[model samples]
Target chain A: MPKIATREAYGKALVALGEENPDVVVLDADLAKSTKTIEFKKRFPHRFFDLGVAEANMIGTAAGLATAGKIPFCSTFAVFATGRCYDQIRQSVAYPGLPVTIAASHAGITVGEDGASHQAVEDMALMRVLPNMTVFVPADAVETAGAVRAAAEAGGPVYIRLGRSGVPVLHGDDFEFVPGRAVEMRRGLDATIIACGLMVAQALEAVEQLAAEGIEVGVLNVHTLKPLDVQAIVDAAQRTGAIVTAEEHSIIGGLGSAVAETLAEHYPVPMLRVGLRDVFGESGRPDELLQKYGLTADAIVDAVQSLL
Target chain B: MDTEGVVAELAEKARVIRRHIIEMLGEAGSGHPGGSLSAADIVTALYFKEMRLDPTRPDWPDRDRFVLSKGHAAPVLYAALAERGYFPTEELATLRKLGSRLQGHPDMKKLPGVEISTGSLGQGLSVANGMALAARLDGRDYRVYALLGDGEIQEGQVWEAAMAAAYYALENLAVFIDYNGLQIDGPVNEVLAPEPVPEKWRAFGWHVVEIDGHDFRQILAALAEGRHTRGQPTAIVARTVKGKGVSFMENRVDWHGVAPKGDQIVQALKELA
Candidate 1:
């Protein structure tokens, strides 16, 4: 079992994409090392830009690059990429449908002791509402690389949420990524647990624990938040009588709300949204933060057990 | 190209653009006629004489890029694109209508020639700076041009972009400040005076060029000088009247975003002719 950080996957994928496509350009707001784009910067200095501590300007520049037929991949902390530069992304990139891939690393509480200010719990909500913007929360390092490749070929504005810490490499090299589609990791008739990002691994763990206790749990990894896999959601709702959604984002207006919205209109079920409560985070270790925020595998197990 | 001939042609085009502005605003029943009319000459010179673009290929890779940072004045950009053959000239009358490509604010997806969708002031300049730097990194020969309203320069982001552009030495970027001295509220001096604007840009390390907004020759020469400029970006501060051709509308802040009435539209058009 090999371990790879999602940020490293982004760097590797960026270099590969740059090699394959001349239009692929990378921009960083002086976080090339933190965001893991330093590798690409070293290899292709002509195709890389260091925009200093100006995230808003970086986003706008990425939009301009897109307008000039250059596919720009901007890397930075998730908080700065989404929170600090929302307007820039909204008007310049998302509004115009520019093919700019905002590779947001250090997403969620897994950003560790850097604390609450660095953790971006609302990036998904902020990006998903904009028209023509695609939001992708890849489950692990392998999937992060796949999502990066998919976004480059998608030909539109995309937000790829990644984490700073090393996560298990669940998806193999051959695992294909299709935008707006969900991947079912397991099949069970009892109930479904929809998850994304770091929580996907926890949900799988919960499913394994639940299986031993004679409770079958269906686990589906939902990567793309906008243009959600509505059909898969309906199918899961029909097959399973209950649903539990887990993510590293805020429970409000995120993966949980997106799932609830889909089910409320079509198939109503006993749904439990497993995510952070309506509160900002503080300084804590990654594992401690996940436990304090109730974003652990044990929490998923408890949530699924309660539905029974 | 002969600079005089280009300026004369652009001057004539500006007249047609003013006529189009009044007609479009009257048809839409509402629009920013003052700023739009003021910006007509600058946009006309860019599309007709400065930019290397094919109307049929709106997304040409190496074509010079133009962004309307002060996006509320889309009529001027629309007029330029319409004259440049981006879409049918007849569609100009349908400005701001439901389902019309020409939106009240520029929408890059709907409109053919729009580079970025902008309406919120003080943001387009940063986007332009990004485009300019991207071109430099790619070693592309194309340049980027952005139009900013003097009133809109109050945004902090504008200065941030100014500093960044100069620091990056983005000489391939050219910015035009339509110094109309009037915003929607009233005279810009009374509202938020942005005087010593050229000095501010120069302090930020830009190659500042002050010129007559309506003088096509000055506009062309300034653009040429901006190209020859090295080690920093250039800002052409063009002094312009709010509503140049229409006697009643000129220098009137009230006309900043107001459409002309039935008789007034005809009068404005006649003056433009």
Candidate 2:
């Protein structure tokens, strides 16, 4: 399979959107190179604004642009993009329900070496709790591109979380992404593995590993965290009889908590959450951090085995 | 209207807005009264004399934008919007009530004339910069105005926005700082001084103007200067009394966010009349 970073896909998708829509403007808070919004800046110099290292100002400016009929895509690292500017997002963007796409790159523990300060483990929970916000955690490069395009078309506040590290491309060119819908990657009746972001690829590998041992594990990619595919999760839980959730984020408020809340409300199912258990990340390689945080194929398999 | 005529009309309008602010705050029995009264003249001048707006067409693309960055002054903005016929003036009584369009803070979605929802300090200037940039991008000449409290600029985000406005050279944007010098805690100087405010804005590459915030002529002249400025944004530092018009409430820190009670409301209305 081809390999690409979700941030790279986001950059390409933004350039494409800018070309198609003259109203599409891009803003970055001094992280254009890292966030991959330098691509959009290079293409449309006039429409791109580099707002220095000020996330709150960037979000407020994006809301103002939205009010003036311009669709703004504001980019920065996830930690600064959501946490640093949360009040600005709530009061300016979400309060008015502006069509500002917050393209937050380097989300989750996958943002390695920079340590916990840079990694945004709670971004999903923070954005999910906002009244008018739609949170998207795309599985791979293809889905990231689809998510960017979808956010541009969807005239409201959307937060598209992108990764810093490159992962294997899991979707084909014809892959369609529907917001609030889950895609089942593998079929099984014994147990279901619900995941998002880098964990989707890891869950696929875990499913294959579990299959070789006469265990049939289902894999479901929950790309959209808010407006989550509740029906799909409930159906998967009903058929599989057990559930496991995996992500490159914290177990407290990321994919695991979202899936658990859905199942607990709709159908009570025995479950195990595979991710960091209320701990911050540390300086290490991307793969090392994933392994240390218990966010790998082996961890997902262990979670499934424990549930079974 | 002639210059004197415009000034007098605006002054009377400011009085009406001040009366409404007192009446509405007393009705709600809760709200920030000091900031609302202090901002009355500036907001009145903008909505009644300066801004090119049609109450019937609130979504006019070319309409000048006003963002109340010091959003606790929603009573003032709501009063001005109602007086301008944006909504029924009777709705002024519904502020902070359940399901009222007049939220405790200005809500752009709830009120048609509100350009941007702002209650959080230090965020509106950045929003104004975006609107100015959008005007430039869309090839329109609409101007953007933002009102900020003096103490509100203490938030680090305000400086971030101030820096960006100068960097962008947003000649079409104007910002007003209601330098009433009192916050809820105490005097803004004793609390956290944002003094040398004019120099700070000038250092940030803005055309700095200082004036009496309650003087309609000065307010109108400064706004005109801001409109004519080129290559950089303008910051108008308007020195104002915390609670203007009501003699006992004026400059009184206790009245900052407190609603006037029965005797206080009667005295305030009498003073305004």
The DockQ leader among the candidates is 2
lDDT of 2 by residue, A1-308 (tens): 77799999999999998999999999998999999999999999999999988889999999999999999999999999889999999989998899999999999888889999999998998898899889999989899988998898889999999999998999899999998889999988899999999899999999999999999999999999988899999999999999999988778888889888898899999999988888888889999888887889999899899888
| Candidate 1 lDDT over residue span B1-273, tens digit each | 576676677788888888888889999999899899888889988998898898889878788999899999999899889988999889999999999999999998898888888998988988898778767766788889999999999987798788889988999999999999998788888998888899999999999999999888899899999999999899999999998889999998889888999899888888878
lDDT of 1 at A191: 94
Model-by-model DockQ, in order: 0.67, 0.91
lDDT of 1 by residue, A1-308 (tens): 67678999899989888889988889999999999999899989888888788888788878877877788999999999999998888888888888999999999888989998999999999998998899999988888888999999889999999899888888877888888899999987899999999899999999999999999999989988978999999999999989999999899989999999999999999999999888788888888999999999999999999998
TM-score of every candidate: 0.96, 0.99
Instruction: Assign candidate 1 its CAPRI class.
Output: medium
DockQ of 1: 0.67
* lDDT (10s digit) by residue, model 2, range B138-214: 99999999999999999999999999999999999999999999998999999999879999999999999999998
| Native contacts kept (model 1) | 0.69
Q: Which pairs clash in model 2?
A: none
Model 1 alpha-carbon miss at residue A219, Å: 1.0
Calculate each model's fnat, 2 decimals.
0.69, 0.93
What are the Cα lDDT values of the candidates?
A: 0.90, 0.93
Model 1 Cα RMSD, Å?
Answer: 1.9
Q: Which stretches of candidate 2 lie over 4 Å from their true place?
A: none
